[model samples]
Target: MSWQIWFVYGLVALAVLLFFSGRVRLDLTAALVIIALAVSGILTPAEAVSGFGNPLVMLIAGLFIVSEGLARTGVASAVGVKIAALGGRSERRLILLLMPVVAVLSAVMSSTGVVALFVPVVLTLAREAGLPPARLLMPLAIAALIGGMLTLIGTPPNLVVNRALIDAGRDGFAFFDFTLIGGCILLLAIGFLLTLGMRLLPQRTSAPSDDRHRRLHEFAEHYGIGDQLRSLRIQAESALVGKTVGEAAMRREHGLTVIALQRGRWLSSLNPVLVNTRLQADDVLIVVGRPETIATQTTDLRLSDQGFPHGLQRRYRESFGAAETLVVPGSPLVGKTLAQANLRARQRINVLAMRRADKPLEIDFQDTQLQSGDLLLVAGSWSDLERLTGPRTDMVLLQMPAELADRTWHANQAPWAVLITLLMLFAMATQVTSNLVAVMLAAFFMVVTRCVEMNEAYRSMNWQSLVLIAGMLPLADALAKTGGADQIVNGLSALFAGHGVYVILVGLFLLTSLLSQFISNTATTVLIAPIALNLALGLGYSPQAFMMTVAIAASTAFATPVASPVNILVLAPGQYRFSDFVKVGVPLQMLALAVTVLLVPLVFPLTRT
Candidate 1:
């Protein structure tokens, strides 16, 4: 072997160690690998940096925009609500309903975000529907892992393989390429959990339910300001449409407290309504004041009284529909109070009560500084209330009243969202346009048709994901350029000489899946894909089956919380032990392996001999 091969080998090993160490970010580690190769003269500077400009990167980014459009129009959450409704408050049935629904959602959007949004809903179901959090969460996590299998943009690994095929001078996988195999696998997964999987899950204890009818309690209990918490929408010709919260001054003249400021229905996001944000037609105001005062100003203010939740109208000792939000550890609002953090002025939610360590603090909550894990019971419109769901969110919503379910958003722009997606799929499947061009066009139409906002399109992208894939792409090029990929493939192929192609498939699946349980699935795919492709060609088999094996194995990341972000999101709330994941995940991984080995050959034949 040449010195260059030895050097590449050492660098690949070091990069793997660093990825598992968790000390450095995966993208940065990938960047280091690219720099080392470029500096060592194994790859030219242009080759080292070529990955960032790849069309696959653009395709992924454009898909993120299309997904944001789906989310903005309430299409995604509406799907969740519909499927959840099918559960009918039954514990076992809800698990059956939630698992497939979540899987389907994850097939389109980020699985991590889908799990984040549903965590609170799952917790609520456990408490009210009398289910164990563990029983529901384990399936939720596993279903999300399976969801990534169903579409072209379902997971990053699928795209990595397609890029590998394209780089090898073959056509990339079509948009619906994975649908047949992946959809079959998804049905099997759903069946597995519905039957044997739940028995393996821990029957952990459930948490207590919260007060759902206490929203107006802030106004009635504190100041006797109003008997009902009311919402009013400004009409197109309303005088309040162009005014800011401060200018409206409902508190001074109408004895009304501005609780939340909301945006238009066609727009995206459940963010808090800000005080300084100018009101638009259809902009809803969540306010607390005397019913008569609000009614008197409705006509004069040129507003439409949107009415409060059903429970709020007849309720008193309790508050209006309330949700508990947790202050995440790294949140910038960690040390600030309601007033200092400007929660009201910015997100426009009022803090009714604060609790730490399960004990309610009797001090003035508005003046009190919030620490990590502090839970605040907040009141606002259901649409404005569902905003805080992910690790990036400042306040993680824990639970919301069931009354809001009836008032939740729907799939209004669903047809447009579906049309754009289908157009992209047709372009890819038919090869009429490049994958990048197809997705970008779909993304453009999504925004022009008001399916997604401009800002949200940008936010939907996971830059680290894009950078991680871009940076790691050069490693494969370096491997092939420096003869490292050939060396590795030859050594492994010789070790299994005289063995059938099925043996190689099993080895690749096991190696990739095992590594994926510790490092990320995408990184695992990037590192192993080239070798799998090389191995197939040497054996006179087409790269088709081998590449498919690598992509599917890369997604078998069920062994640990650290395996994927979706697992970690559920860990604390599920109160699962590391052993808990392994207890169930190990068996599931074995099931996937059997399924892949049996299915891959049937789907993509290796009969090149």
Candidate 2:
């Protein structure tokens, strides 16, 4: 091997370590790879930097915008709501229905995004369906992984393989090219889970768990804050729909405190709440009052229960009512007056009383300026109260009284959201243009169709993932340009010499699958696909066979919680440990492997040439 190949190998090794170490981010590590390759003369400056302009990068960016459109329009959430409604308290039937819905959504949208939409819905559904959350959450995450297999744009790895074909001077795969193999695998997965996977799911644990982390009413009891915490939606027909907190006189007329108003479809700190912030239709108010008073006010005000279907009467008694939380040094709520901070409107907690530096503020608590050491008596769901003490926010939950329930806003556009998603899918499947052009067009339609706004489209793009992919592409280029890919291919050929092509196929599958367990799947694919491509070419077999193996393997991030973001998202909510994944995912991984090894050759044909 030449000096350039040796240098590229060393550089690639260093980059892989940096990726595994988690000290530096994956995107930054990718940029470092680009710098090392260019400085070592492994590639020209333009060659090292060429990945930014790759068509795959544009396709990924455009796809992010398209996904943002579907989310912003509420299409995915709408599907979740419908499916959850059908869950009907039967675990078997719920899994049967829920898994397929999540998979189909993941097939069209980002798998990670699908997981995000489903987690809360799963939490709510688990409560209604009388199942432990852990049982439902793991399946939801797994189904999302399977969903990515069903379409070309289903996941980034699928796109990587198709791009490998195009870069190798072959026709890129059309959309739905993955459907036959991926679909069959998905069906088998569903069946496998229904049969064997049912017994593998976890039951609720009893390790003195935090009650605040449990179901809504349980969380309320854990915090001693019961019916005082309630959610009300300002409907169009309600008298308070267009009124501001101060104008509505909730405190004077009804003895109620408006904690937080979940106003607008999107919110940020830049959009601050004030006393004059008017309530709009569908706005959810986290308010505090006694059961009878709140009920009387809601009846007269004509407010909807804000999607909180839990029976307050059932959990009413046995209350410490509300508790005081101390504000330690450096909370966001510090320094602002009760009127200025608008804790009710801003953080969605009612500040009933305050004691500054151990001295009670018996009078004028509302207008008094907050200090660093203020102890605040607040009321709301345990969940909202817990947020104040979170590492990201200010104020500790006092570890006692805090709980939360699922909340909703702005669901009226759900039909439009679904319609826009279908249109986007149609464009991609038909190849209305190149995948990149179609995505960009669908994204534009999402904006012009009012499914999403310009700013939201901009915000929804996962720039980090995009940069990570773009940065890693240059490393792939360096390998091929420096003869490094050929060397790697030669090594694999020597190991598998005189063996049937299926040997190399399974080898690549295991290699890619295992690497994805630890590293980013897309990164694994970018590095391995080029090698697999060259290896197939060297052995005089169809590269498509090998490329397909790599693609399926890359999506096999089922062995660890860290394998994929989809897994991590469910870890806390599902109360899962690292070993839980191995226990549940290993068998599923084997199923995917058995299916892939047997079916890929039949579909792509190792001897097609």
Candidate 3:
């Protein structure tokens, strides 16, 4: 073998070691591969960086943005909620109902995003049904992985293999080419999970129901402010009609703290009680104080008594929520009083109560000096509360009320998101434009229609995954250029020289599936795809069946927690161990291998056209 081939082999071995160790980020490892290849003069700089401009990378990026649009607009959340309702407290029935819904969504959207959207929903289902989260989360992850096989754009591996075929001077796969085999696998998986897979999962006891996620009333009860809660509406002729919340002096005169303001009729609008929030006629103020003090103050201030209605609680849950934030050591607010810190004016959130030394402070606690390790209960619109989760030096958000997940930011825009997604699908299925064009148009429409904001569209991208794919593409090219791929294919051909093509297909599937468990599936497919193509051509058989098998095998990352991002996502939440995956995942992997080997040849013949 030439020195170039030897060098490529050495670099690939090192890259695989780094991938398995995971000490370096996958994208960084890919970057190192690119740099090594370019510096060794094996590939020119332009050739090394050509993968960045590849249509496959752009298609993946566009799909991410489109998926984010659906998420931000509440389309995915609504689907999850509707489907979860059909389960009706039966663990078996929930698995039957939930897996198909998740699988179908995963076929169009990102599997990781689909899993994230459903995790909380599934947790809620498990809690309501009196089942352990472990019982359901594994099935959810497996369904998502299988869902990726349903469409050409469902996963990166599908695109990688398609690009390889096109580069090999063949036509690429159509949009729904993967659906038939993928649907069959999904059905088999659902059946397995409903029966044996459920028994294979661990039954770790879930956190107590009360401890899972407390409601608004539960939070008020914990803080001892439930009895103090009151609501009052402003009279038209009242003196405070035009005064701001700070100027109203409700706290100083009546010993009542204004928590929020409801401006529209029927409590249609709710906002955090910021200092600049101006009071107006018919505006309702949700306040906390003793009944005697509140009654006397209302009579004097010309405010009409409006008892706290149950509807207001529903509105509060929908538009506003509370969160617990801890003042960490070295925080700038550690030594300042709540009034001096001015969180209301700056963050537009009310500090409803504070806790120190594991006990709730007195109601009149704003003047109290803040200290490290102090926990404050703050109230705000859900959007503002979400912002606190970002990078901050003053305080860290410890927990949010569970109802926060039900709050939707752009519920009104949901129809537009759905329409745009459907239109994109129609375009792709009909071949009105190339797959890349269809996806890019959808991404553009998502932003133009305000389904997702411009900034959010950019933030929604998984840059790490994109960089990893782009960087690794050149490595595949280097392998092909230096005859490294041919060398590997030659050995495989010799091993299977006397065997039937079906045996070789099974071997290829097993090898791809095994490598996928320990590395990025896209990278696995990129390295294996060219070899599969070369092997098929060298054997005088068509490459379509082999290429299709490679793509399907790369997605069978079900046997390990570290295998896929979706698996890692559910690991901690489900309280799972490594053994739990092996107990369930190995059988599923074998099932997929059987299905792919049996089905691919039937769908795409082995004869070269």
Candidate 4:
């Protein structure tokens, strides 16, 4: 290899490390890699930029826009809400309903898209059904992973590998070609999840493992604005010592939406409106809604700083307009009452809301408190706020308001939209039309018919993944062109030379599984597809079988957030620790590995050497 290639290799290694470390954003890491490749002359500026416009890359981007359109129309979220209602009372029934639905959607759309849309829904449904979120989110993520493996255009990784194989002069596997083995593996994994997987999850871990999230400390800081959540002694003049939330509401007529009633530390969401539920002194009412609304209705209600939006600008002058603020740990207002913070007056901004890592705010607006990792929704000119968060070492602004695209999805023509989208996917699968053409037409139709607005369509696409794919595709091509693929194939073929083709098949599956955890499925597919073809050539085995193995393995990212974007999304809502994934995921991974290993060799047997 030349010095340039060596340098490229070093950059690639560093990029991979940073990707798994989760320190920097993935999009930035991908951008840096492309920049390094361009500077190192591994790719010309034209070649480096060409990946952005690649048809496959464009297809992925377009699909994201389509997914965004669906989201805007409330179609996807509506589907989730409807599914939750249908699951009925039984947990098994719920799994049966959600798993297959997620799986099928994943097969047609992006897994990340499916997860983003459904993770919240699943969390909400689980809490409503009174089941732990840990029981459902793993299955949801895994099903999405498996569903993508079922078809050619199902997942970005599958598409990347399929296209890479075709680009390398081998005919790509058909859309449904992976379905038999993939379906078997998916069914088996789902069964394990429903039967044994739920038992392994940390049942009701210290955090609210249910999707409702409502953590006590965070809620107290962010939403508990007033004496709605009082921990007070029965003073000589106090009026609520024995009066319940219902009694106070009926008498005081305050617009208090009680999230929960806590008496002597016992919390209950039941009978929130019943005035007869006797309340003792020092009992807390975790309420929701506006502070002024609460105070005007209730008597002697001293406002506290429970929901005094943390992580927003604490001190904003007029110059702090349209900028960003970061929330640092151990700041002056870390645990202080919002009233004490004088957030509205001193900061000259409105504390809109706060999002905590562990739970959703449950208490009424009058009584929440701020906590660490609380993303405070503040309304102010960004330039007016000073940098209390820190320069480089403290809690940083993870996202800015302007950077957040408005995802106000609206589904105007729901039936026609879904029908046309399905037809397009079907055409792509059946070979009646190319995916590139079919999806493009679908997008065009969506625009011309006003099913989705042009700006909304443009805004919906996942530009990050599109850019990453575009950058990596050329590098993947270079790896094949540089004889890097052949080197890898030779090593693999030799290692499994003595063993039967089954061992080689199993090895490929495991290798792809590991690579997928570190890099994206799309990157894994693009890089591994060429090598799999070479391995088949070396062993005089079926190239189709090797390709299928690579395709299947790349889609099964069940182990960690580092494995898939969908996993990262549910991590917070599922209230899952890193270990929670492994505890449940390892078994499913092993099952998928075993099933694919056995089934692929049987279905597409290797020729006798």
Weakest 10 consecutive residues, lDDT, candidate 4?
Answer: 310-319
How well does candidate 3 score on lDDT at residue 417?
83
Give TM per candidate: 0.52, 0.56, 0.61, 0.54
Which candidate number maximizes TM-score?
3
lDDT of 2: 0.68
Q: Write the per-residue lDDT of candidate 1 for residues 9-95, one digit (tens) a residue.
A: 788778767755657766687789779878999899999888789765676667667756655554544454455557756766887
Best by lDDT: 3
> Of 1 and 2, which scores higher on TM-score?
2
On residues 291-357, what C-alpha lDDT tens digit does candidate 3 reach at each position?
8888898988888888886546545665678888999999999889988998878998878788889
Model 3 spans > 4 angstroms off: 74-76, 83-96, 105-145, 148-184, 191-221, 225-318, 323-378, 382-415, 449-454, 500-502, 511-587, 596-609
Ranking of candidates on TM-score, top first = 3, 2, 4, 1
RMSD of each: 11.5, 9.5, 8.4, 13.5
Order of quality (lDDT) = 3, 1, 2, 4
Q: How many clashing pairs per prediction, in order?
A: 8, 7, 0, 49
